[model samples]
Target: MEPLTEAQRRTLEDLYQRIDERVSPIAGTHAWWPCRKGCDHCCRHLAAPLTITRLEWTYLWEGFQALPPEAQAEIRARVAELEGTQRPYTCPFLDRESGGCRVYAHRPMACRTYGFYVSRGTGNWCHLILGLVEKHGDGDIIWGNQDAMEDTLERLSGSTLSLFEWFATEGC
Candidate 1:
């Protein structure tokens, strides 16, 4: 695959920024976003449903390349377990010892917007936040529109894949 050019990188950055802006409000308003530095529950979930466009995956790969050789080997080694029929597995990029993304700065849109919805679609919001919002009768709960996100991503990279699959198969 061709290295991402400067313009493409900037585009991806802009997209990430948009997602960050969307997440910021929900994170700030909801005291239930217990996603602290060491909280890796979402990343460590079995049957994790991480999804991202090729553009996002490419960015992730870029981050992967920058890690030390030992870290890269460890990431590659985790692929086999992730590919197995096991019910639950941690994300390969997750640093198990620290419970953080090895590629935090370049994490994909899905990772950026996981706890909160980018749109008005409900159901997937954090349970605590959802109940609080409901009890307080504050406003509608809008989750990010994954379909709409795919539409925009398809235009950029023309492909999407599960995050685990990407790690397992190296985005083949």
Candidate 2:
């Protein structure tokens, strides 16, 4: 609940850098890559409320504060409406009209690593990506290990909580 310490901030930033390095080369090189700005399929098809580490929530809050009052209000309303939502609910941070994340840059590692990472030797991505991989083959794609990334995040940040829980606790 406290502001991130200097060391924590640096470590999180380093993680971000590593993610960028891993994602950069493969971002647009392959036709099978379905992740892009305005492509919100992942956002729309979340299996559960997005869970994030304390460090990630701290950073995401910074981006939330920078938004206009109206935008923040809209997001707040959306979060409030999600209390009883079913599985595969849309992300509250998604800007429905634009089909983009409202806090893309500050989103948690889960969002950052979504389609680009593989878990348990399998791709952790959407149906679109699966279809593409089936047709074009996944040989050219550069995949980051989701399990490793998750371990790094846990080591850097400690405890984790769902986005809804964070909103409830922070009263933001």
Candidate 3:
């Protein structure tokens, strides 16, 4: 992953701020939103074998570079382990003790928006969030345009790679 240029960082910050503006208000409004500090359900279930654009990857690398060497090594180890795993892996950035993102500020858009995302399938949301949403039962369901967002990211970045593979090959 390349170092982020100043202009790129500015653009990234603005984009992230826009996302936070939307997600934060809605997330905070739901007092019962099950996405608490220790509840890293989505983080565990939705790890990176998924495609993320090069720009997003570079931004994430910037965050990874900021961590202390020990933390970076630990995260690298986690990423290495995931290289041979099957689908549905855990995020390397997860802090095991804290059960939180190590690079929350610089997490990719996919990481930023993991929730009861509306699926393209008939009357379905993401399965991982099903239990958390069961109690609400579709009363003003917190919808997420994950598909559209992915499309937008792909368009903007213009280069795509599997995140785990990217990590393994690119080196923190």
Candidate 4:
């Protein structure tokens, strides 16, 4: 994979910072409040074929490097197994013991954008929004501008790699 141009890296970082600010407040509200400590329901599912930028890949590599050597080896082994299967896989960054992402700070956009409202289509499929309900119940808060944020991220980055592919190749 090619390295991200310095301009692309700056743009992506800026976009990430802006979205973090905007989403953090709304995420604090009741809609996403159920997402408390140790609730790993969202982490259990196999994620979609998320395409991240090369710069994002580099960032993820940095995070992986910070882990203890044993942890890194364990994760790389898991990733290798998953890659051999050629199917969707859970994030390698997820700590199996703690059920939390070890690289939460540098997690890709798709990881950060989950559990939020997203609208689609002109009728039944349209106006769909979802979020955490509560500590035990559904928070179901909706933010109208998430798509815009996603668009902005894509436009600014100019690079993309699938989440699984990223892990498979990052360590090679």
Candidate 5:
């Protein structure tokens, strides 16, 4: 994939910022939400099959390039281990010491979807994870599901590269 042009990068950043602003209130109001600073459970447990556009992939590749040599090697090793595993692995971009994403500014859509509400569509009931909701408390809010967003991103990007595949193929 080609590198993102400055304009493309700006656009992608704008899109992400908008999404973050729109989704934050919903996520912030959830009850049982243990998503406090230093809590890394979601990053540790969730499988992030990235559905990034080529431009987004380029941005992530840039992030990989910015890391120190040792950190880059570690990330590559982790990616190699996760390449074909059926189970999801922890994100290589997660900073274990900080309990936060090292590539926060360039994180994929899936990373931004946690701690929000997901509608069931059939009137079945909108669901928020109990643990999250209990911690954050329900405030008036609406948001899309992580699964739906992932599907939509995949469709829009016309790409099937999983997170690990993207990392490996992009020379990250």
Candidate 6:
């Protein structure tokens, strides 16, 4: 992978801004929004290896580069061991002890939009959110447009690949 061009960086920043714009209100107003920091349900029980755009990988690489060497090495080992892992595989970037993302600021669109976004009229959040919504009802929820965000990401990023694939081929 090549270094992101200035335009690409700018585009990523804009996309992130749009995501925040859509998510912030929901995160603030939802009666039982369960997506606070230290809530690692989604990270711990990933349904699949996260797929991300090249543009996202480029940005995520910047965050990976910022970590200390020891942390980087630990993440590399985790990725190496991810092969053949089962459905509930934990993300390598998650800090198990702290239950927070090691690359929270640089997480991919999927992570950023997980609890707030909807596609095909279905919420993409974890069971905790579902439970809360079930109990509180979804009348106040403002779901972000996942499909539109995906389209924009495709337009900006061009190509997509799984996080595992990115690390395996690109050498993080």
lDDT scores of the candidates, listed in order: 0.72, 0.85, 0.73, 0.62, 0.65, 0.87
Tens-place lDDT digits, model 2, residues 27-95: 668855677777888899899999998999998988888889999999999888998989888998899
> All candidates' TM-scores?
0.80, 0.93, 0.83, 0.72, 0.75, 0.94
Candidate 6 lDDT by residue in tens digits, 1-172 = 6999999889898889888998888878864678888899889899888899999999999999999999999999998798787888899999999998999889999998887888886656577878888888888667888999999899877779888889988964
lDDT of 4 at 62: 70
Query: Which 10 residues in a row give candidate 2 its minimum summed lDDT?
Result: 27-36
Residue 100 C-alpha lDDT in model 1:
86
1-106: candidate 3 lDDT, tens digit per residue: 5677888778777767766776676567777676667888667776446567778888888788899999999998887788878768888898988898998877
Kindly indicate the candidate among 2 and 4 with the higher TM-score. Answer: 2
Residue lDDT tens for model 5, 75-137: 778777766665456777778888987777777765665554353653212233564455664
Expressed as tens digits, the lDDT of each residue in 33-65 for candidate 1 is: 565678777788745546677778888888888
Instruction: Give model 4's TM-score versus the native structure.
Output: 0.72
**Which one is best on TM-score?**
6
Name the regions of candidate 2 deviating beyond 4 angstroms.
none
Task: Give me the overall lDDT of model 2.
Answer: 0.85
Model 1 TM-score, 2 decimals: 0.80
| TM-score: model 3 vs. ground truth | 0.83
lDDT-based ranking, best first? 6, 2, 3, 1, 5, 4
**Better TM-score candidate (1, 2):** 2
Record all residue pairs in model 4 with backbone atoms less than 3 Å apart, i.e. clashing.
Answer: 34-134, 52-161, 132-139, 133-138, 133-139
lDDT of 3 at 36: 61
Question: Which ten contiguous residues of candidate 5 have the minimum total lDDT?
Answer: 119-128
Error of 3 at 24 (Å): 1.4
Residues forming the 10-long window of minimal summed lDDT in candidate 6: 121-130
